[model samples]
Target: MKGLTIQQMAIGDSATFTKTVSESDVYQFAGITGDFNPAHINEEYAKDTVFKTRIAHGMLSAGFISTVLGTRLPGPGTIYLRQELKFLAPVRIGDTITAKAEITGLVLEKNRVTLRTTCTNQEGVLVVDGEALMSPPKA
Candidate 1:
């Protein structure tokens, strides 16, 4: 287990996870989450939308942030408390997305940490940005 105790984290501690979005990835996310939004699953319908083509579900990319939080930084036993996100750009099939979480604040008394979370695509365009509150594993 990669759990990091609250004492082991600092204001700048960070971690990242990346993956290339694929058609299969999108469909799998749709099936699991029951999102099935046309913007994500229907190419022809997407063509008429502002994206002009199919785009991956925003939450699918957001989930990458969870990967970083749960498996990398304050890893394993970290408890996710809250998150606020802003979707800035569309993620297309084959776009490699890198999700990062950097510690920004800590509440020692509550054993909580605040992280600046973000996801960027292959073109360096920010696709998602957010803040997350979590509880690091006990020492």
Candidate 2:
């Protein structure tokens, strides 16, 4: 429960979670969400595309950010309100992605926190960038 409450969070407080993208990750996500787009599942189709290989679903990497917000930064019982994401680059299998969130604003009166969210790959290239609005459980 490392996630902080609104009263406890500072403007610069931050947290992160990381995972190496695997073939299974992509497939499982596709299975769970039923998003079997050729770009993500068909090797032959992907080979002809711009990426030249299968890419993990963008939302799968975004889920890592949710993990950080729910379990690490604002811990459990945090309610996600809104998220804005920009998929900057493709995440291929075996790419280690690190998702991070920093508290940039806190509205104590409303028990809301504004976080700057981002995900970066093993090569140090940013794959995603976004902002999230959340409500941490009232302590």
Tens-digit lDDT track for model 1 on 68-133? 999998899999999999999999999999999999998999999999999999999999999999
**Clash list (residue pairs), candidate 1:** none
What TM-score does candidate 1 get on C-alpha atoms?
A: 0.98
- After superposition, the stretches of candidate 1 with alpha carbons farther than 4 Å from their true spots are none
Q: Could you estimate the TM-score for every candidate?
A: 0.98, 0.97
What's the residue-level lDDT of 80 in candidate 2? 97
Compute the lDDT for candidate 1: 0.95
Please, what are the lDDT tens digits per residue for candidate 2 over residues 30-134? 999999999999999999999999999999999999999999888898999999999999999999999999999999999999999999999999999999999
* Each model's lDDT: 0.95, 0.94
Clashes of each: 0, 3
Leading candidate by TM-score = 1
What is the alpha-carbon lDDT of model 2 when measured against the actual structure? Answer: 0.94
Scored against the true structure, residue 136 in model 2 reaches a CA lDDT of 93
